[model samples]
Target: MSVRHDWYQSESKVVITVLLKNATEKNYAVKIGPKQIHMTADGYELTLSLLHPIVVERSSHKAFPSKVEITLAKETGERWQSLEQKPILVAPTIQTKNWDRLLNEEEKAEEKDAKGEEALNQLFKKIYSSSSPEVQKAMNKSFSESGGTVLSTNWSEVSKEKVTVKPPEGTEFREWEK
Candidate 1:
């Protein structure tokens, strides 16, 4: 039997919604890895080779009575151009799909909170362990002013040691005559 499926993507996650087609949880089996997904529901066998690497520990799925929703968390912040080698799962029910609403507001808020906490913890460790007391104090002040956020900037200087200008030994270097 052929299975029907649907999919949607977000900035940091991909949501794969499989059409249950009246299948129950007990009738389905799923295998998920860092770069692939295999699912057998009812009489259909579906496979997906992910377009990019994902955090297996952070990805999850829920088999509801009418559908199975899989949430994949990307390891990097890059947006995915596609989910699999082929186009998304073919399903006649895509017209009924709610593509915009993946996670509810509360769920999104919780994710933001967890990510913020982790970033702050990492920043704290770096500040306390690597910085002098004065530098640490400055970082704390910056964080306070920025509401505990860090904006990355392209702030860098060319290495003087790597820059060199040498005239060719054989070729006479002459200035252009005006």
Candidate 2:
């Protein structure tokens, strides 16, 4: 059986939505791990080797009449290229299929479908995930210290001085209440 699902990610969590009409809590089972997810519903089994590690203890899910939402807390605040890991190799010979290429193209299509804030966040994540350690550190420091008002990719500038909040032209920046 084939299972249909979709996934999206935030700065700290990855949310997977499985389309399973008529699904119930008692009829479905979801298992989440640091690097994988195994799910079975209505005799349909689906497994995914995650692109990155998650905090299993902090992850959770909920079932609805029309779908299931699984939320995985990321171990790191890095962006995921896809929900599943890329295949390393394919069957050899003339009959060999380019499964990896096909999968990559599909993933690209999914990424392209993202819109608005989600699309922007995904772009930032992709940049951060592929950047150097110094750049990542700069981004984290600047973004955090500036109350999410700034994001700097230049390590030389970010590392040399502290980042200060720069709110919007008409907005005032305030610190979070503890």
lDDT of 2 by residue, 28-81 (tens): 999998999998977787898998999999999898888889999999999998
| lDDT of all predictions | 0.71, 0.90
Clashing pairs in 1: none
Off by over 4 Å in 2: 90-178
Candidate 1 overall lDDT versus native = 0.71
Listed per candidate, the RMSD to the true structure in angstroms reads 27.5, 28.8
What is the Cα root-mean-square deviation between model 1 and the actual structure? 27.5
Query: For candidate 1, lDDT tens digit of each residue in 1-178?
Result: 6567888888888889988755564488778899998888757888899889889999998887788888999889887877886656677654564545755766898999999999998986875678666556555554444443432121121111222223456644344489
Clashes of each: 0, 0
